[model samples]
Target: AASLLGAPIGHDLCIISLSDLMTPWERIEKRIRAAAIGDFVTAVYNPKSEGRYWQLYRLKELFLEERSPGTPVGYVRQAGREEQVVNLTTLAEFDPEQVDMFTVILIGNSQSYEAGGKFITPRGYYGEIKMKTDVGIGQDIMIRSFRTIEKELKDKEMPLDKKWALLHAIHTTADFDMENILRIDDHAVASLYEKFNRGEVRTIITDVTMAASGIRKGALQRMGIEVKCYLQDERTIQLATEKGITRTQAGIRLAVQEHPGALYAFGNAPTALIELCDLIRKGKATPAGIIAAPVGFVHVQESKHMVKPFVSIPKLIIEGRKGGSNLAATLVNAILCYNDAEQLKPGRDV
Candidate 1:
């Protein structure tokens, strides 16, 4: 396919004809490579016919080498005619087999994005969309901060759930190092949201009261999820005194005995996480999920390593000794608001 740049309406768009009927295939390929290297939004005409089936596939492979899989691609068939058909898909999902001689394909440039079911190429101007008046200044500032973090993200091609949680983690700590430390299981956020929405998992057990209190009460109330900490429980104190174990470790035992299926979160006590791991191994507790981010220099690294073998459980872990109560709570917030992931919207209950 010959790629062409057709910039109309003062925007740069390259139009290339892939028809080899009147042009040499090698010359057409050279032009396509140049357009790809130039990062031009491209349009292809006569992409495929019965004799030209493999050409479109090669064109797609060439573009992929220079483009993000998230790049938008749209196609129209029999344009300006009653039989016209339009389709929008990503470059990763673009199907060459669906094209014919009558179809015209348009691929988005680096700055182009898909919005509202249409491919949008910016005309070099942007305006800030104001939030509602009732959202308050703090929420507005937080939203702005999220946008800034998003723009500076090193890898913006991650899954929506991971990206959503990453924004919150970075916003809370203002630590760019979090981009490298945060590790989330595939579909963990979405699967937990489904469970929470169905009221399957309703309790969260934190290693300390700080983590329990850090989570927003409004969101917990709205979701009907309880944040529980057994650190101050009389039974935990007694268990620690009798067994000569750390109070936090004893607290996990009491919490697990009471709420075996609760979502277990750790932010300040590695000993507590290790104790839970012991319980899980012994079949004494089966948690809904785990957030292993207990921050410390002691057994912090080991505690995280302890939980990784249970691949069946959904988990979110901060790999190093760089986690805290705020980080743990923000991740919980990410799960509570995951329905807004597609829009990158947060603080629904704020």
Candidate 2:
């Protein structure tokens, strides 16, 4: 079965039912020792339950005699279901109580490590090449960013129109460094807008400070939206313009140096954003896809784990590790399913 499924030779299968309800402990122990001597990759079934728990520990000891502690161990709890939790840990950390009748454990032949806190079991590419797996990392970062925004926006749900207009005005004003509003609130609004426009947000809100400059009024006017502001301050407007240039210049630098995959910018940071945009438009970067967070950016191309071919606007404005992880997992699942279905279909030959 392993060979037919493209698994390598010398791959022997060992199954041990950890449940003591039917199978005696003596029989289970004997099978464990035999499989260890046989050097077979073992799959455990019925590893834990309310009544039985020590089997998992005993099996670990049995395998430890023959196998190195660094062996790759995979845990699939409730596999192929909505409540599925799959992870690869080391044999040393393997716990029997973590699994029940619904769990399946696969332990490999001594090659696993914790990289950046993730358990990685390499197949053939251990020393071959550096993996283009930064997408996964970037996705992780994006998820963190999204959670921040989601928490901030949790309470304000209805009347999205007010949220939308205010958010837009706030973002525009903030970019211009407009004053009269608290700096912290401006930062929040700035961050919120940046996050929202990245294609993730459906709505947002802003605070209005009248007698502040007509910046919001002017912006609303240009956008054909009506809004009234009290207490317009010319002094604040003057200072905002001076500070805005400095902010824009800083953004341009960070976007260029910090973001590896950013090919373009679409907002007020014109000199920098426009340059990047032009490069992207001209096909120089040939970006696999675009990911926008509140202030984070990354580019990705399709690879084994990520099977989606590069497309325009793969995901917009959604940020953080959770979003990226979900996207990557979805893409991989879709590709694998499609490939399997294609193989099973009738041949084209007449």
Candidate 3:
């Protein structure tokens, strides 16, 4: 059966006969229940015959209790013989009349599927190679850059999401040192992806106009997310002068007040990052995430360290004072790239 079906029975499986000739009906029922509960792919032999008709119906009913209606079920009659016949169907659509003593019924696990006239039960390595091949042909440079980064960081212990984000950063900056210096909270970037995909994030607040300008406008427009920088606003100037604070800091305060829960990306001013952390700590603002990468020596490290304790919010921080507007924009674009890749349909141009 395995040879005929291209190794569908390679995983956990059991074989049960429903004839009840040598085995009692109660024992066969118990075995079927055990297979179903154990999540084992089952093969039924001698399912039905002229004298044994009701047992196959009972077996299907019991399996349906534990399996999904759409679970793939394949039956092969007279396997490896001249009169061999094979048919693929789901558990809900299986006809007991088509199965007889010479038929072998193979029931798949929950992860199985029927495609291209074949039934397949994936064993965890299903689409790994296909995805790589697709990405290789679709985006050659991106795939090559990712592979190079993966090779370089082979020994580094980091989460997969962080590795992907850092790969884009290194690809943009061409600086390998950024890999070690970047600090990402666990699942931080993934949280951003979730918010972005769900359309929950509607606005992006940037400290500088340059950072805002760097974000992909078309992508943001398609996603219905607005990029805003209040540095040029008249209100920001008045507030900064009155409070004796930097214009970027005042802009952040005002932006947070106006666009609560918006993502904040700061690339030029350490004061802006510091102000955002202070505002969040004071309960004056609640942002979706923070991408703080202020480049300089003065208070840069301090400002980044201030945001480190914000464990609840997703953050992508360049640990030292080694970031600039370009890196910040690159990080934002990296997120957009991920979103675009997710939206890419098979056989469609990326």
Ranking by TM-score: 1, 3, 2
Q: Whole-model Cα lDDT per candidate?
A: 0.82, 0.39, 0.77
Q: Identify the candidate with maximal lDDT.
A: 1
Q: Give each model a TM-score.
A: 0.71, 0.31, 0.58
Query: What number of backbone clashes does candidate 1 have, counting pairs of residues 3 or more apart or in separate chains?
Result: 11
**Candidate 3 per-residue lDDT over residues 1-350, each given as its tens digit:** 65466435556778888886887889989999999877778988988867889998888888777775556788999998999998888787899988778999998765455556767654443335333233445454455455445445533445556766787678768888887788888887777877887998888888999988888776686677889999999999999999999999999989988997999998899999999998998998899999989999999999999988888988999988799887787777666556443221111222
Write one digit per residue (lDDT tens) for candidate 1, span 144-179. 577567656788578988888898999999998888
Better of 2 and 3 by TM-score: 3
The candidate, 1 or 3, that scores higher on lDDT is 1
Deviation (Å) of 6 in candidate 3 = 18
Compute the lDDT of residue 54 as modeled in candidate 2.
79
How many residue pairs clash (N, CA or C atoms closer than 3 angstroms) in each of the candidate models, in the order given?
Answer: 11, 20, 0
124: Cα error in model 1, Å: 6.0
RMSD of each: 5.6, 20.2, 12.0
| lDDT score of residue 324 within candidate 2 | 28
Q: Which stretches of candidate 1 lie over 4 Å from their true place?
A: 1-55, 62-67, 109-116, 120-183, 213-222, 231-247, 341-350
Q: Pick the candidate with the highest TM-score.
A: 1
The CA root-mean-square deviation of candidate 3, after full C-alpha superposition on the true structure, stands at 12.0
